[model samples]
Target chain A: MSSYIALFGNPNTGKTSLFNNLTGSYEYVGNWSGVTVEKKVGILRQHGVPIVDLPGIYSLQPLSRDEGVATDFLLTEPCSAIVNIVDASQLRRNLHLTVQLLEFGKPLIVALNMVDVAEKRGVKVDAEKLSRCIGAPVVPVIARTGKGTKELVRAILSLSEQSGEREHVAIDYGQDVEAAVQKISEQLPDDLLASKRWLALQFLEGNERIHAYLQTYMDIAPLVAVRDEAQQALGRPLAEHIYDARDKWIVHAIETSTVIFQQKPLTLTEKIDAVVTNKYLGLPIFLTFMYIMFMLTFDWLGSPLADLLDQFFSGPLTEWLSKLLTLVGASPFIQALVLDGIVSGVGGVLVFVPQIFILFFFISLLEDSGYMARVAMVMDRFMEAIGLNGKAFIPMIIGFGCNVPGVMAARTIEQPKERLLTILLLPFMSCSARLPVYALFAGTFFAKNQAIVVFSLYVLGIVVALGLAKLFSSTLLKNESSIFVIELPPYRMPQALTLWRSTWDKGKGFVRKAGTFIFGGSVAIWLLTYVGPKGIGVSMDDSFLAVIGGVLAPILAPLGFGTWQAGASLITGFLAKEVVVSTMNIIYHAKDMDLLQGAITQHFTPLSALSFMVFVLLYIPCLATVATIRKEAGSRKWTLISIGCALTIAYTISFLIYEGGKLFGY
Target chain B: MVLTDLRQGQKAVITNLAITNEVVKQRLLHMGMHEGEKVCVKCVMPFGGPVMVEVDGQYICLRRKEAACIGVR
Candidate 1:
């Protein structure tokens, strides 16, 4: 049988990095909590034993959705061993979870990650002493540089090879609590993987999941009675008492096993935080960085490469394909399907690959360097003013890449009301899928100010999202503000390997979507345009698509660009935002085979194009996003509210832009 | 005094967590802000924004209102 070992740790302790080092899989590793929201499994590179990378969590008793995932897996999965990774520098807090894992009685190995970082701060850990104290093997490793990982894996394999039964440590929860736990342990089911003592402790700490799990086997009334008695005896919530006991145990273990010289003073992270989190200069500095990122995406780096790709696709590639097809005596339909349907459609979106990669590159850099948590800190006041917590900003930043994970990332927020509001407002963040539309329009019409125009659209998205957040928080989702406590992880130079991995991970999604959804969508649109009420190979103006687009055109007339082609693109855009560009490429190229940029310029002036971009910005999120909102919000009503709200906002704003432009005689 | 009242670089030990919300209390406690733990005021943002505090080698940022609920001496 293939043995399963889980890599577990508190957040920001390089758990994912170590998993990557072990499995040779490139999962994203950010220096913050809640980065891995789901459990990822990979086979170890050498031993081939499957390793699961679980989300970083504080304790087995989960407090958030991601934490719940970790705890749930531990309670249920029959893992051979648990690799409890801990940050050597923050051993005090990180080991709180470690102590709880030890209670589960699994064959456990401690990976003392970030030991170099600890040593730089004058802290030295005796790994053997720690192992002896905790009754588990401890391996010191730096996960980021892959240092000492071989020994760590060898330790895991050795531990797994041992006899299945290993000793489980039980923390003494004092006299009163221990007696109460003993009473509760007798009532636990006999078949549980975890010890009944651990279950009894979790019951006393009010872990509902444990109670619910035990409910299936036996009545939980006796368990509840024992828990309440313990709470009363302890004269406080049992969770606090249990944590206090565990904390003392951890402090004792550290004191006996580790030594600290004089502490190293805070260095670069502090000096930078002094300015980056400054009251006066913080927001401006943030805005400056955003501006530079956009300028680089649109003007400096991405656009020039995109233009060269566009030229190659529309010029040489098309000519070569057409000549080859004609020489092979291919039919006109096949020629059109290959050239117009597939090449033009998928090519339109694929040309923006450089821009998408660049945007993700910058985001990964900010995330890996630990600057994003400070951004949340600096924006807390602004967020609170709008009745949301600062941590809500993290999901919105994630939403800028895609709304599916963004909605899921809201699981980190403790409060239900705030999480829902974050989910509802995330669609307006102008995800990377919409980048091609902005690039197409800005490159065609607003060429002189391409960077600024694109930058303005992103800013507008945030402004509109904030407005809606204010509206929702005060009206439909009113609740007390959740606490804002986030760790500002020490900054480190971003690893180039990690950065490239994340950039490729996000950028590859776009290419994959183009090949699948956009490819299928373009072929369908081509067939619809080719076959009409009259016959096949008719003018597109008289085809089935024209009739469909004609019916939808008038509804969008007030928003400018009320043509059937625009209407058709908007309709297909519901599937995915990138498909909007693909739909346009097929529809426009069907008539005369014109370049997409030139075709867009002919149909839209600068003002109308700007309005269209704003429409795309605020419109309904894609189908995947809608389903995610429905699932995460766990209510069909809120899902409808999201779609309804987005449509209303998009229509109203686009109407104002178009009508206002016409009134000003633009 | 409450945590927000501490001046920059001032050290104090948390005496009581006055907040009643279970989730918020647990979050703070998990960050090593339990009673009797030592804390230092790192930075206080302008205009009554959040306060940054260092506790157990971890820097945590808390809103001013939340900071006021953390009793220290």
Candidate 2:
């Protein structure tokens, strides 16, 4: 039989690093669970031994979904040995879980992880002494460096093979609680012995799940009555007292076995946090960081790459396809269908791929570099001020990169109501794909104040998001205050490979969406316009979509973009936000424009362009985001609430901007 | 008073929890934060947002509003 080992530790304890070094896989390394809803699995190597890195959790006492998964696996799985990875720098807290695991009575090998960080901070641990006290071999390891991993593996292999009766370290819970647990355990079924202590504690805590579990498999009514009496006599929660005693015992043991001073060297994260988390300077620093990122995105990378792709696809690809159709003697109607509808519509959306990649690449860098958590911390206060939870900031930040993942990532928020609200409001954030449309307008009309105009549009997006979040929280989704507990990961120099992998994954996702939805949507939009009542073609600009858009045009007149072009763009944008840019391109013959001729200037007026950009920025999120809302909200009603609210807000804001500018004689 | 209102390093035993939501109640129970747990308030972040508390030998951070629901004596 193959030996099995389990990797366990608190969240952000570099357990994943150790797992990665041992296993050699590059899975997503998020500081926080992008969502707290799922359990993830990964394998590690140890000479024919299977090692499983359980999800990073605080203790064996399960709370969140991931925590529940970890605790359930450890308590029930047939693991030959447990590799308890303790964060060396934060020993006291890390050891809490270690101590809890110790009570499980498995063959334990302690990995004192982050020894390098601990030593730098002037905190020292006597691994030898610690080994003696816990009756487990303690090995100092820097998981991030893969140092001491071979020894850790060897220790696990030897421990797993040892078949002696395991000794459980009794945490001296107070006499009364211990008496109650002993009585309860004697009444429990034999099957509950694996986690007898945890089960005992759960019974004392009045856990209904344990009661149901016991009732299903064993006779336990007598046990429950006795546990209820014990609880009543205590006049308090037994889990709390048991936990207190357990923690005290562990703290005392750690103090006796380890040496620490009040003073420790400042960690790199500490030094960085001092400025980045500063109350006064923090927002400005964040703004400056975003400024540099966006400036580089547009001026350095996005514009050139976008121009190159636009030339390649429109100039070469389109010409080749058209020539092929001409040579093949294809019907003019079919030629127009493939060329004008499919090529023009889909090709327009695909050309902005360069800009989307540039945006997501920067976002991936921020996430990998550990700066995103700080951004969350900084944004938390303001989010809280508006009666929203801090965790909302993370998904909203992801929304700026792309709303699909942002919507998916909302699962991390423990409160369902808050999670739904965040998802519904997330689409209001100006996603990266929206940036191209904004850029096209700002480049064309407000070229003199391009950066400022782009910045203002982003601000408008945020303002609308906040207002909607507050509105939804106050009116429709007012359920309860959300549970907000987030871990801030220490700053580390992001590995290049990790950054590249994330960038590649997100870039690939963009290309995939372009091929599927964007391709299909463009063709659909083209057929609606081209295949009209008239023979192969009347003016498509006078088709059914055009007439409906014309009717809606008057509604947008106040925003200085009353044209069917802008109206039709908004209608197609419901398919995908990137379609807004493509809709503009197809409607305006953007593919035919000469790049050297200052295209933006020749195309759109300043006021109409600004209004069009703002409308795109503020309008309804795509159909996919709406579907996510329906699924997460579990109701068509709230989904309708979200749509209605978003559309109203978008129209109101755009109207204010357009009407206000005209009133001031713009 | 809420955990955030505690002076730095003050220790208190949770007497009651005002959690009305079942999800939060289940989460609190899972973290060993049932009523009567002895929780020592560690340093609060510079702002009155996420308050760090040492509960059941575990140092976990929670938002102030969440902590407010945990009654301490």
Specify the highest-lDDT model's number.
1
lDDT (Cα, tens digit) per residue for candidate 2, span A173-269: 7677778888877776676535677677766665555555567777787877777777677777665676577667766767777777544534565
Local distance difference test, each candidate: 0.87, 0.71
- In CAPRI terms, model 1 is classed as medium
Off by over 4 Å in 1: A1-3, A235-237, A590-594
User: Residues A1-666, candidate 1, lDDT per residue (tens digit)?
Assistant: 455799889888999999999999888789777899899999999677899999898777777888889988977887888999999998988899888788877889999998999998889999999988788899999999999999998898888889477765677889989998888877666788887777878778877778788888898787788888878887888888888898888898999999998688568778888889887898889888888889999999998898788888888888999999999999988999989888878888889999999998988888898988988888888898898888999999888888888898899887888888899999999999999999988888888899999999998999999999999888877756656778889999887878999889988888899899899998998898899999999998999988898888899888888899888888889999988888888888832223667788888988889999999998899999999999989999999998999999999999999999999999
TM-score of 1: 0.97
Winning model by DockQ: 1
DockQ of 1: 0.75
Question: What are the per-candidate TM-scores when only chain A is compared?
Answer: 0.96, 0.81
CAPRI-style quality class for the chain A–B interface of candidate 2 = acceptable
